[model samples]
Target chain A: MKLSIKTIIPIIVILTACTDDIINNDASPSNIFRSFWEIMDERYVFFEEKGVNWDSIYFDYQPVFDTVRSNSAMIKAFDSILSHINDKHLSIVSNDGHYAGMFLNDTLHYSISFGKVYSTYDFSNLQTYSHLHLAQLPEGISYIRILPGLKKINVNDLNIRQYDYSNGLIIDLRDCTGGYMSGYNFCSIFLQDERVVFYKQTKAGKGHNDFSGLIPLKIKGENIIKKETPLIVLINRNTYSMGNGIASILKENTNAFLIGETTGGGGGSVMSVLLPAGWSLTFTQSKHYNLARKLIENGINPDIENIPLIDFWKEEHLDTGKDPQIEIAISILQTTK
Target chain B: MKITLFLILIYLGGSTLLVAQEEETKSRGTLHNFRFGIGPIAYKNYYSIPNGLAGGSMSFTYQMEKEHKTKKRDFLLRANFDYSYLENSKVLTTSEPLFRRFKIRLGPGLLWPLNLKNNQLHLQAGGNISFYGEYIYPTESGGKHIYHPIPYGNWSINCNALIVARYQAGRITIEESLKVAIFTAGFFPEFQYTPTSIDNSYYWDFLKINTISTIPNYRMIENKIAIYFPLANNQTAISWRISYNHYNFENSQKYIEHNLGVGIRF
Candidate 1:
């Protein structure tokens, strides 16, 4: 049978309209989440290691899910929450993770490459180091410069991997937006106390946990080198989420002196959902804490506030080869300790 | 409300078109035909007596067209029925009466068609005569009641002169026309006396009720002036006819009602 011209045209028009609707309809989560959940449940290698109850996990989380209202907010929430996990190997991979710094974006990726370290007063010479930069100033103070969350560099790896620390150490967190909270994993190299390592802030309030035995780094296969080296940590406004979190951990338990700008205020552990529409959303799962639930959302402030070194970099056109705030720690070690 | 009734008329007309087509082949050359239709209907009347008044009627449409030998001109005879009622309630507190009335019309006209690509232009002009068929009135006295009906005929007349232009686009053709009808004289004794009472002064109020003698023995004439636009094609088309009908009673009272109808061409 043959169709008339009039019938054919209307049929074509109706089909085109239906196709338009199909393309525009957003994919709902119900379709994508089930398969993803099934795959992870059956095949994830770390399913047993992480001690995660995959089935109960979905059921418990499903009822409390809220739709992400905006994209930017989702990214921010994702970055903050992922940073709180404190495991160097685990971190959210996204384009926004580059907030740590332009140089960090280049160097800090999933894999770690060990290289020579150097430091300079001028940031314009940062590329000169080509690897991590370690600066020794006028005093017995040492500065270790690098952005966090850009690498899978665990503290155990660092402790085992040879590095000399003869003077008071200055850890720079300026412009360090944040990454995994595992900075405390290497604390044993300088801190010996097992009292308070960090604070985990949940809805119920603050809970203190000791990382003293968490990352056990064994040196020479015999003794635990618990170096009580006096530490001075430097932070700036960009010392966000996990950066502030680690700083809070160090401040309460160790001899670390916090200096320079106040840390970025970002509390809560983030929960993320990969939407069926190929979009992702991240939200705060729980609150944050400092000392006994002191200041949940408010960030960690420094012992002394110093002018942001970026201001001087802007004024003098001298891009410090490393975080100048960390240079401040090296300078403080020369004068005070 | 008038438009609603007109839609029902068209719906019934649609079914009639299908039924009528079965009996008659598409008429060729010159043709004249009449269409009769009716449907189940119920509505509240607005007369001063029986408030809920419900009734139905058979509508008639007649169209006659003849092609001229020399020119593409055609003479057409058309007729339509405009039936309605205004019913009121039994004597509750207001000692007013209630009644219902129906109107009908017939028109004859000529048309000139100009051929065009994808459409046709038609210029048509026509005139018509219209009147009521019956009037029913009910009276009440505190505890007593009475009912009555009066046969009314050929009460109003109107001469409609319309110049319409029509265009056919595929299955749809649209026509717009201007019409002006002048009221002639009534058909009964109503063409004589003039009453000044408020109730009788308003021709519409009296036309709405039913009374034997009180049904004024006067001429009820109407003049309609309007612009009508109808879009239609071979199978189906929607016609929107908007017109103003003015009533002139011998009682020296004048009233006007607006009319609109959506019709389908067979």
Candidate 2:
């Protein structure tokens, strides 16, 4: 059949003329308020963990949402509800761009504490790369500090097996905060043996407690870390989210000894949403558990809870009576190897 | 609201079409013939869920036929893309969360004409790079939709091939050319290649595969049945076509939809 372009052109024009968006972008104030609350009502996984009365919340927030004449007011209403939830990942979305950050403020000096650890090695002389800090101590302990919000590191880049440590290696995750825990499994240098790393559960229904059967997440051991090579992983209260996830995994999968205080437990994997006001919100969609089946949503305790002294911040660890975590780690490694 | 507007638009377009504009006749065997058309349809649609959810569907197609006067079959190249989506334009929350399934195919095939008694029939077998995806989103009334940092959104993709057959004919008896008209129907089977676990989160590092990434034995099946009538003068520029589609992707997702559309056959 011979079809003419002259006839087809008009058909194409008429057909393509509709400017309707495939996904309806409805931005009405009431829709925004209702959708935001409904999305949270059905999607947030931490409701059971938090113990808040969701019904009362809706009743409380519905009135607030009713008063929202502008995006800023909408953001404020969202902030009021999210603040009560007190979850690390729960973020309310808006189309107009204001977020929870504009309201929530923290006074903790985690950065200063992190700086204290950096001073252990000459800040200027430390070998640095993407999200990684590797410094070989004269005591033969290879010092590696992973920063917050970093992704998986390539094994080839680390060449972890090539490092000759007479006193083993120290993976200092003092305040490491972000990224995926499963992502860092590429650093297989730490996997000691075949082990059940963790478990993950995703939401399946509208019920707040509704969840799918546990998906057994595992990591098999493969490597050449000699028995004589000792490993010491350090953690503190600020070691949260992915950092805590890393700590819990190492505690279960590796022979690495943990020193320092407990980790900051924030084990919920995140899910995101966008509001009619144009703000992007995120919150925990699933719960993660360690092999022991503990919701690492709370911090995990270290093997040896050696608290680093305040004076340890004044100078390097070599200063006796200071830096008890490092001193204990080195002594433990010396005796073990 | 948007759906009512769309229906009105479809009705307007259907009413404005020049059904009697073109005359129906056998092709003169032009080595290359180009065509394009659009239409509205109604179909049962489901993504990730078991039961079919009914919805308004749309289909678009563009094709070209190549053959010589002496050839028994024509080399046919065609691209077809269709979608079935469910939404409540008025109550965004009660909306079925935009359960959408998209089927697209483009490639070349051989269309062989069958010289039956007073009938013009064609058998088509083609190898197309077919891509099918059923996206499941969590949405609610009032236009509430889940967005970025989405921990749980399913994107099932299947890439495969298919076969089709259609019959179109002119007035067979000289007595009544318009009493009863011939319609066209086609059936196609697709072998799907899909992945089981692809954590396609926007936050992941792409260059390196995440350790948890698992590729399991995944299978998908798709079959389509279509019937179209040449409403005016045998040139189906105006026709009522109904298409039935059954798509199964692994055990987690399956869809069956019956679509009735008015299309302009080029």
Candidate 3:
């Protein structure tokens, strides 16, 4: 094809005419605040459920942000803005350290500490994996304690057949914060059948309510634990994310009874992104729902609620046989047997 | 850095020697050139890494040109790959994020000689339709099975305006080419998400067609300068090239690369 210089010159001119610079080059307070707000507005998944008025937040914070000068002030302003949302999955990290929502600052109370239980309990044939502890309590009851940040749990290592669950089995998930969703596989050993445990939906667009179709999350039952075996799951406000998910699964699918306080709600899938101002922001990217089609973001409720008297975080309470939750669990298992 | 400087100095010295030698011209029916390059690259993806990653890039290109009395028609195919390492920090530990990129471009163009007074100066103007694809991923630390590497990809059919200028100095030919994307129909993810599975459904969701123009949504410009010296047999020639490329997608994701290469034309 032959083209004249005149035609080519005009084409080039027209092409160059449609340009916009979207990148914020300056780190001014207003720019930083705008970037943070805009990023959350575009990516955060819980505005509708959390009842966050994002446009109103922008209007309110734009004035506050304009007055901010230092990075510390900026962080404080950001924290203030995030405080309006109740999502525990949301956090911002900078050189100043990690800043999270109000839920994180609320001092969650957990019933039992695995460290104390290991030091205090009379257990036999103990097995420890990364983030998992398996042992046997008295009366032929099996005890499994799951810790936070559970990445991988090999069912083979648990030696499912070696232990006896004739009396009952206790799965302790207290204070277990979020980890890989695959960590829910720990429940596969007790699953009675292949079942859809929950559903998840991710943000699909810029709109607040824009979400993808629900993707059912299924877990196959390994039948390692027989249907007649008694299973008890322990949960508290500290049990979150995958921990919350496991508790819900055990309650709905298996005959496992839940004991302890309502779980710390962190049902959403968390993802982190780097902001233009060098701060990293983490927020929920997907919403998780239980089999009942209810949002698990607030947490899953236990069958029998028990609040701990001793502070689990305090070392003085460590290894004390005074944990009422464990005693109640033992009593319940004995009664069931 | 020192080796790069030394090689550049040698290239300049060789070019000067060729410029001082006798001037010559050759007419050929078809010419093929193959090039290989490696150089340091600075990269960043706003969706993945916060800081700019320092890395190296390697590229290979093959070109075939059909020469006529007044014009040259050329077909070009090129591929470039990059690997960058993130610096360890408080947030990112042991298994730090590593950025990797691969790009492929193919196009055919027509070039017509421009009327100029100086015999040494040869200029041509035309455009080409290029098919371009790029895949970029910043690997996150964790068990590979658990943590999905979020990928940034661009697949576009673009119309590129091309400008080529050649100057004959002694027995060496100094050539410069400029190509700029004028219009693009492309696919880029509006938001970053880890695909639930490596399936066609995820690809369909991620690869929605988004038309972008040079003015606002997307922009790409590539410039290359090469010096060619004919071999003793006159059937083949050795060349050195330096090129710079800049790309902006949706004004949010940006990429810049520089390359120094050695080539042979037959």
True contacts kept of each: 0.00, 0.13, 0.06
Q: Interface RMSD of the predictions, in order shown?
A: 38.9, 10.6, 7.8
Predicted model 2 interface RMSD: 10.6
lDDT of each: 0.40, 0.51, 0.67
Tell me, what's the RMSD of every candidate? 34.1, 10.9, 6.5
Docking class of 1: incorrect
Task: Give me the TM-scores of chain B across the candidates.
Answer: 0.48, 0.47, 0.77
- What C-alpha RMSD does candidate 1 show over the true interface residues after superposing them? 38.9
Ranking by TM-score: 3, 2, 1
- Residue range B1-266, candidate 2, lDDT tens digits: 35435544543443333222233436535333222323342222111221122345566666566765576666666566766565433332344533454666555655444444423334444333332323343334212443332211233222233344343433320100000001111221111111111123423322222221112323232332233343564323322222322323222332323223333333
What is the per-residue lDDT of model 1 for residues A1-337, given as tens digits with 9 covering 90 to 100?
Answer: 0232244235324422332222212333333334234423422223332355556656744432235444344444434433433222222222222121122332122121112114244222222122234554434454565464432233444432233345676676655555533333444445444444434432211112111111111111112334466678876666665666667766875678899767665543443322223332233323445655464345688897876444444444233333445556667676654
TM-score of structure candidate 3: 0.74
- Return the lDDT, model 2, position A45: 76
- Deviation from truth (RMSD, Å), model 3: 6.5
By summed lDDT, which 10 consecutive residues of candidate 2 chain B come out lowest?
Answer: B173-182
Model 3 Cα lDDT, one tens digit per residue, B155-213: 77888888987767776777767887888877765553554321124566656676566
TM-score of each: 0.33, 0.62, 0.74
Candidate 1: where is the Cα deviation over 4 Å?
A: A1-119, A122-139, A150-156, A159-164, A193-196, A201-228, A309-311, A315-324, B1-266
Q: Top model by TM-score, which number?
A: 3
Give the local distance difference test score of model 1: 0.40
lDDT of 2 at A101: 32
